[model samples]
Target: MMNSRDFHRSPSFTERLSGLSTAFKMFPFIQTGQRILQPFLEKFGFSVQEVTDSVKLFLTNGHPALTFPFLRPPNNILIGCANLLGSKSAPLQFSPQISQFLNESVGKDVVYVSFGPYVKMSGVSWYSQLVEILTELDLRVIVKVDKEFEKEFPKSVLPLNWAPQKDLLRSGKIKLFISHCGNNGKMETIYYNVPVLCIPQFADQPVNAELVKVKGFGESLMKEDISVRAKEVIAAMIANHGTYHRNMKRASDIVENEPGNARENLLYYVEQVAEMGNVDYLVNKVARQQSTVEMYNLDIVVPVVVIVIVVVGFILYVLLKFCVYFSRKVGMAGFRKLKNE
Candidate 1:
């Protein structure tokens, strides 16, 4: 996820042009430790170009045509737009339990708290304290998790194991959403024009949360600061009195009512690709075409890996040999002592 400056605003010519390169694709990203060694693979003469050609196609899950048109360029990225249907449809139903919780919260103003379906509240004290503050402010709370809590919670709070998030956010009583700032949750908030209070939980969450603030849809607080800052942020947004609400509504209309909205463009591309028989000609390139140095580098990497393995094996061997030698000496000494006794 890019900042609004990179999303709605045009990128510099360099960034746009760099989009054509594979290195640029991972530029906004950091490789996890497992993949951190990937740069060394490049030193082995492995071509990222070949890897790029091997992966047939890539697609995004957002409706970029209307939501973020700047994504239209760089040709490789396309919007699959999974949320379009949910946005265009009615609220969802997860289970009787969540439905009943909604029933119990009829007249109260709710600040729905969910860090996506997969994320959960890891801090019991912080969460419990946040609940106290919200209820004291006369705002009800909904904490969505994947499992039931054994502890009895206050009447002002609803700890639902699961929820039809789109439906719940659209419900008239919802005043604010406390979310993980995941893309799907962000889209739902946008769909319903629900103001958000983002407590992003890593990955692209921080970026999405920043967008929520940047676009004036809501505020954000780090999870670490939630204990001290959650009440402050929540109060500010709930009291927004129409700023976040109005801005979000305007954003919703912009994404949905805009000409050539994402849904249509997404379908057009799908049909076009389908008509093309799912062929990606780029993947058809010859793998053997390479420079002498690039090809020889594979041989170089083989020895490097093998030499490391050999060194490790030799160290283990010496350690084992020492253990055996010492054991033999101790055994002999013990046997001699026993005989003398």
Candidate 2:
């Protein structure tokens, strides 16, 4: 009784009701439902093959499927700010304005703190407690306070809404980072080869925190008893400087060695796909050939030759033009001399 487009546009009453019911339920129920439905859908030809193929492609390209790519085998995932070869290890630089203040306050013993952007300090009472404990320690603190806590903390606390985090980490002035254990921050700390005191809020944070402890980079504190835990953890971090530095160095090495820049790798893959007309076999073959050519230094030779030729041609053209102009001038000068004679 309806056109095809109209029929497709209209959601079934049953589906609408089901969606409404799901919305009213708790978050856990929605997650449970998704988990249950995912396997069923995959089995019923929803996305099984596509998912498998995509994962295979990533793995084949030297990417890790689970865990931080910078942490484990294949060792081709790029996720840090340091050079992998460790050829040029240097201290991180912080904003000059804050650096002066930090140097004056803590001298060579300052602590950096960040709980990530999403984790609000207002909703978490432990933030205030942690601040108080850090202040009591008489340590110079660079705490990245969220918008909610901006007015709450005193001006002298070095409270920042956002910071040049990587630069600060690389700065030798920062002795420790109190983090939420987010992967980016974790990787940054690793790249800077700095120790961390993780205060996990939720999600993968607990897992990351555990890994940090396991890897000996640093320790984690309970979010609830932030003050007490932070005090103990900070003491531990300061005392056991050797282990943290060593672990961070090792992590930095791995991160630096990871294969492929995200942009470069992604564009390479996309270009490959387009060039090969989406033929998987052809794409693989082309990639293999390109790798071989690169290894053998074959592809570079032609481009270098072309560049040289172009440069030489330009120089020759200019020289020829100069010669032609001089010849014409000489010819005119001889004629004028003869006429004058």
Candidate 3:
């Protein structure tokens, strides 16, 4: 799992197999995590089974179009919750430098770059190469950087302590987004129909980056390969800008034009849960209620398996004995004939 976490290229057969093996290995740890959280979960009158059951409805801020098509979600999973917290937020107020950059640059000639809060750019090995590439690009760049790295960028690039990321993505000025591919950031880019160049660092970021590429909304950059591959990728994205925009627009429409509103869906489910007091019936209670032995039917299976093995062994033993006895009888008859002669 760790091996595949930062893979920038398409996964190979070995990597896919490793992922499968990792998934199998993850269940026990997931169960252990559930057990560890049992004490806190019990306070809410929920058990490990109830928390882990498939019947339990999951409300995510993800849209169906943004998610991989191969994923088969259960009926209880209510996706496309992108705007559950209301569609819009307070308008973003950009700094004087940022505003000036946006005003001066032609529409779709500006790029917004951010790695979210957790990842520090200073520690990244390809940071210098990234800065150089951004500087050389004809497009105007707005980068959210740590204060220490602010002086590293040239005056041509606008380096700020922070920027209104989601608002900027929504704004018509941003031509491309250079992001860490965090879930919220990825969702925002998808929602706004903004093409992205993913520079995923860790966690689910790489997977999200891969999905972006697979969906044809954008491409991804590896930490190690950023120096070597960044320019080529950025050039390709620039050349194929319209195609990316169209792909993203289609995805955005899917998320936006879905039949029901996410806020309404959330409210309806909440009301149902409140009225019912217990949503256990929604899940497969029989499977959850079963003991480990009963779940796998080891009680019945183990005995049957053992009995079959023993019975086969006994039959083989009896056949061996009969063969020995028959051979001895033939030998005695031959010996008597020889003595008589």
lDDT of 2 at 337: 100
After superposing all C-alphas onto the true structure, candidate 2 shows an RMSD in angstroms of: 23.8
Top-TM-score candidate index: 3
Residue 17 error, candidate 1, Å: 12
lDDT tens digits by residue: candidate 3, 198-290: 987766677778779988989998878887889888878888889989998887776666667566677777887899865554444343455
Predictions in order: lDDT: 0.65, 0.62, 0.71
Off by over 4 Å in 1: 1-57, 63-82, 85-107, 120-123, 278-341
Query: For candidate 2, lDDT tens digit of each residue in 1-341?
Result: 11223323333434334443333333343344346446777766775435433542332222222122232112122323422234235555567778677767654567888888766776566777787777777677788877766446554468888887877877666778889988778766766778988887766577678767866788888887674467877877887877888877775655456566444555665576577655344222222233444423334446767999999999999999999999999999999999999
Extract clashing residue pairs from model 2. 76-259, 84-256, 91-170, 92-170, 92-171
Return model 1's CA RMSD, one decimal.
Answer: 15.5
